[model samples]
Target: MPDFTATTPHIIPLVYQPDSAHWFALVRHLPHAVWLDSGRPQSTYGRFDIIAAAPQCLVETRGANTSIRYDDGRTDESALDPFYLLKKYLPADQLPEHSNSNLPFIGGALGYFAYDLGRRLETMPNLARNDIALPDMSVGIYPWAIIQDHQHKTACLVINTELGQRLGDAYNFLEIEQLCASAAKNPAFHEAINCIKSVQKSFKISEFESNLKVEEYQQALAKIHDYIRAGDCYQVNFAQRFSAEFSGDPLIAYLALRQALPSPFSGFMQLEAGSVLSLSPERFIQVRDKRVETKPIKGTIKRGATPEEDAANAEWLQNSLKNRAENVMIVDLLRNDLSKHCAQVRVPTLCELQTFANVHHLVSTVTGELTPNATALDLLRDAFPGGSITGAPKIRAMEIIEELEPTRRSLYCGSLGYISADGQMDTSIAIRTLVCDGDKIHCWGGGGIVADSETEQEYRESIAKVKVLMDTLEKEFGS
Candidate 1:
């Protein structure tokens, strides 16, 4: 662990405020750069375009992160939790404050969390789907940052006193400004001049193929129904993945996906393990000022073809007993999880209808005040692999998921965000995500399964969740 004890912290300049999309084009070309965008009408944190090719340290776990307990059929040990690895390696840094400052990711780890990492926390009593192969966690350190504040129309560069020695570059304010100015004007990269289109109407639902055939899914859903009836579990969120081997340029696919569905929690991470492209709309957990909040999404309906149709769909979902019931189960699950480290727990909103480019979801917000000694890691450990993804009585639901699904969920349900050096953290539920490893690309979608969940309906719902990402890949590489 390299010491980054900055004697004095300082700020730099990014010159012109580069458009987030075009800037992303430039940043993604670099190594270990992550773009966390919450453009206007922000979702969680304000807009952040920060990268660290020259990290102070890097940590990724292999078979050592998680000790094997009950391996029903899994051969690989769980990799370390990237979030936990980051909290251990990086020193706590409360960023320098300013009236116009927007992002809290001053100097933190920029990486991802793999769904398989859960094996570290609990035993896999059932068989894993073994869907794909990828690292459980990977994070690059960034002791310096250049941020763009879209709301205020300004850009600022932040760094610690270790200054010029970190990246081995003799950098001054003027030089840093010139370097950014150059990146902004690079003619080869098209500038992301306007907002990403909010709606995409070209995709047809019939184009996607399911990992499990119709009859297969129906039989599986029946088994889950049996479990519910037997009092084995109340609700289980069973999910199946949709994937095809693709060799297209990942950046192009990401660009197309973002254009079709612009969102607040969207991110692009280029790591040695693989390329991560996420347009997630769900906020799993956020800790700031010792307060923890989670917004779990349980019920979903496809966005209608027209405005009237869309309104009708939203209205139906809002009032649907099944949808609301599905939502409340997860809310109860999360509330109980947070209670472990929280002094107080409250549900600010219940079964609220929220719209996205491709679908409408029933969401509920859960908030808790941290106990005296609770840290950000504590909040994540207490409530992770979010309740919405796993069903009510989380542990059993997860065990059922492993037995039924065909492959491990590498990153689909895991999170991708920053745990700030200052200790403020925000991460998404890892839905609407794509992982590119070599010539293959993996994506997953599913919904919570309750007593009344229909086999075909649940299958269609899972497909609907991943429709945007699948279509983007199809258009770019589906040929």
Candidate 2:
């Protein structure tokens, strides 16, 4: 277990403007890059953007590498993680954490951990019938990176590989004056350079089809309540999916979605099979300086139009016994999960109602110290498919989810982010995530169900949770 503090990457500061347009133009066409932007001015990570690519290695799998999973419905477990897991691949060195430098991120593996990978950890069946035939997991190790800090208005382009090996006369290529002069000569680059703020180009696409009918969702919610009464599980998070086929640009759709609902964990990635557009607000797990933390969001409510009305709604949410109870359940579950790989597991805070642009969520913060022997893969195995999205009594809740949900979750409830060259990492709970599968797009949302949960209320809550993204998609593709 090596820490990144010992390794230092080649860092070159650039004359970066506080915008994504110019940055988007250069990397939009690059292969295997991750663009994680905190669209919101006020974000948890101080409004940072990271564009990393040029993967030296790629790893994709449906099952846990430690587990022996046969295609013919047979499987075995090894209680270990893949040797090539992101945790192991992070460079031995990292960028300085102090404010003196513009680099907020170190180069590392950037991609996603799909929700279906849960079956590999502990056997909970998956039919593996993917409509898009997308990989269960896709993570790449990018050797080059560009990191920006909006608040400080500074940026840097970092290369992990040597100048002679990867780029000829790399020092000359790393010069800001030379790059600026070259960009000034290009039309698109010049336009982006002059662009002042983030601008989204509107788009239009086809309508969508719901996998679960409104009535079907209500019925399923009621059945979940019945299961609760029968002592099967205390809480279960369930979801409904809406899918549509589109031939337009998904990156443009992602841009519109960001404008509509800017969240801290939102990101966009163009992969071989399709593109992943995410607008998630929940922070599943973040590790920095060798410390582990998880922010589990368990409650949701729509915002009100007036200040008085908004205050009333916030107060109502804070005082809601049902929502508060659900929030604590998942927090406790995460605490338990962290305990396996982390020492001194503790809950720093609980049930803080954080308001977003369109909705409010009861979020709780849990922190711990990762044990000396634990690796990043350990955290993924222990706390993955996030307790907030899955439910308390994690395994049992998943069983119920598998039986009720119509479509395979694919990347919906899974997570996406970076495992830095060192060990520092941050991943979102993959909520409000949209998968662009060829000409078809898929998205899902839902909530925790308790013993006294109301079917109609739960169904409505699920719809409200995803309304922002749905509206963005509709407007982007509206007739």
Candidate 3:
């Protein structure tokens, strides 16, 4: 075990007055940058948004290879589990007490854990093709972060000065201090930051392609229904991948997506191979003070054109027996997952109506207290991926997903957020997420198919979920 020095972070207030998107614009150019957005000034689901760039250390896992890259030109290789490597940097007992309890994340690991990483945790048949090869996990250990508390309408540059001092990186520490000072003391610093201006859309105007045709998608749904009837599983989430030739700054597309469809758990991450723009509305899990909560979005219905229609749609989603059953199925699954590392597990909210920019969903909240000996990592490990997206009888549903979905799910249905050094963790299910791999950008949409699920309705539901994203990108970036 390595020794990590404990140090309370210093908070420097910022008067530049920037929202999560604007503050992120200032540091977006930095490598390995991440923005855990709260969809502030618009949505009411989230309160705190954390932004960090140029990590002091990066822990990325690809297949069985895990590498730790440090800022000072140091690289260490390990074959240990990615969770194990991440846990090393997050020592619960050694973390300094957070100076401000309002901030959810000060300094910690911020990144994405791809859904495919589940293969590493549980033994499953390798039936799915490994078509897209990306890091299963990519997280950076940030020494400093800009945390915005939307509830208080306050923002601060919080730095772990002790970690910097312990590393003897005086130059880096001084650079951060100077950066904070400049932002506070100089109004001109705003201009000094390279803000991305509106640019012409760069995506090809050609129609987006899907891995499964409408008929094929329906056929896949039929298979899931058969499985359910055969007593193989109760529900299985099936998704279709849509991709287009994209050639412009994905940041532009991300900016467009956020504006069009703001979500509580939305995030944007710059990775080595590409970038991730997630407008996810589902929260996979959150841990604070050893308390765990998982919000699963199981049922969804498109927003109606009129206010009356919207209200009626919300009412329908709330009362629909099918939707409520789907929500409960996942809630029960999550309760079971949390029980692996938690005590006094309970579902506080079940089948609650939550409306987003495009659709209304039934979301359930499952919470528990971590056992005395269990850590946040342990809780996450037992609940890899998420039950809502995976469906009931998680492992079996995953197997069915592998059999049905044509292409591999790279980042879709994964999680993107932060695990703080002080043992606080918050992550979102990477639903409504996009992946920019080289010249092609991929997007996925899916819904759970149950025994009584309608193939036609499920097909439309899948397309409806991501239609906004596809339309937004094509309209903005399509050449």
Candidate 4:
């Protein structure tokens, strides 16, 4: 097996900026561009934003098929496990240590691993319709990245020196350094600004349509209630999909949504098929220096109109017995998943109140140390699509989700983030996410269905979670 090892990254310092939206203009037009954005900018949860474009290689997996296409016209296809295939290229042992511990990613695989990819990992009955035929996994092996450190007020261009040496041309350190030096002076920024403004006025639709009607959603909730009573599963996370016709650049929509609803684990990826716009506040997993942590968000309540109302709403969520039970159930499931590749698995916090722009969430922190032989991908494979999104008994919950949900979840409830060459990894639950494919853009909102979960309350909660996102886009471009 050929290992694409990386040497110490060449970090070139650049001017600092709080809002990354302007800086992203530099690489927006590049092919296969990706931005792992900390949407909150300089806040506590928000610290780093990594942007990369024109990957050295692209890895895409659909069902049992995975193809790795390199920039030099080298292509390889295989039916191997996607995680095993990724391991061949991103083996954790090959990365060298660097002094810059503050930055999470220098150059590595940055993209989305779709929730449907779980089918490739576990044996489950095919029930949901595959209407949105997106690749289960699509990530680019980038050779260089532009990192924005919002907390320290610093920015830099980091080039993976070893990968650059092989790719040559624009990838070489000198060329990238020259590119960064001339970036600010380039005339493209003005054009990018104009392009964004023009695209913002392109939406023609007046409303979004959901996959499930109110009665249909209520019926699905009844089935979940039946399962809970019969001891089929303790809890199952159910969701509804909403879609609108979209024709213009999706970046305009992303920019609008992020501004209105800033989150810690937000990301945007431009792919060959379409684009992924995520504004997720939940961290599915993070691995650094062999230490692992997964933050699962289970409970939720919509934000109130006034300050007092907001506090009361948050307090209600924090004290909700049903929500707390739903949260702890998933926490236990994740603990078992982490233990498969980690040691001394522990839960540091449970059902802690964390408020986002649109909702109040009960977020819990689960931590552990990676077993000596385990890699980041190994940990990801064991945990798969995350327990919080799936449910308490993950396999059973996923089975129920498949049986009840009308259509396949292409990107929603999956994960979007990075696994750096330095062995550091972080990913979002891919909730509050939108997928722009073909002529339509799709979004989903859902919550856990416990025994006591009411049909009306669950339905209202689902819409409440993503109401801000839908409103923001529709307000900006009509629908």
Top candidate (TM-score): 4
lDDT of candidates 1 onward, in order: 0.68, 0.73, 0.82, 0.85
Which candidate would rank higher by TM-score, 3 or 4? 4
Candidate 2 lDDT, 150-200, residue by residue in tens: 877877777665411331223222443345446646667847523322333
CA lDDT of 83 in candidate 2? 33
> Model 3 over residues 437-460: C-alpha lDDT tens digits?
877788899998887888888888
User: Each model's TM-score, in the order given?
Assistant: 0.84, 0.86, 0.94, 0.95
Off by more than 4 A, model 2: 1-6, 40-46, 63-88, 91-104, 127-129, 162-181, 184-190, 193-203
Candidates ranked, most accurate by TM-score first: 4, 3, 2, 1
Q: Which ten residues in a row have the lowest lDDT in candidate 3?
A: 92-101
Question: What TM-score does candidate 4 reach?
Answer: 0.95
Off by over 4 Å in 3: 16-18, 92-100, 165-171, 184-195, 200-206
Which stretches of candidate 1 lie above 4 Å from their native place?
1-9, 15-18, 39-52, 65-84, 91-102, 129-131, 161-178, 184-209
* Model 4, C-alpha of 181: deviation from truth (Å): 1.5
Please say which candidate is ahead in TM-score: 1 or 4. Answer: 4
Measured over all alpha carbons after superposition, the RMSD of each candidate to the real structure, in angstroms, is 6.4, 5.6, 2.2, 2.1
Off by over 4 Å in 4: 4-6, 42-44, 92-101, 164-175, 186-195, 203-206
Candidate numbers sorted by lDDT from highest down: 4, 3, 2, 1
Displacement of residue 79 (Cα, Å) in model 3 is: 1.6
**What lDDT is reached at residue 317 by model 2?**
89
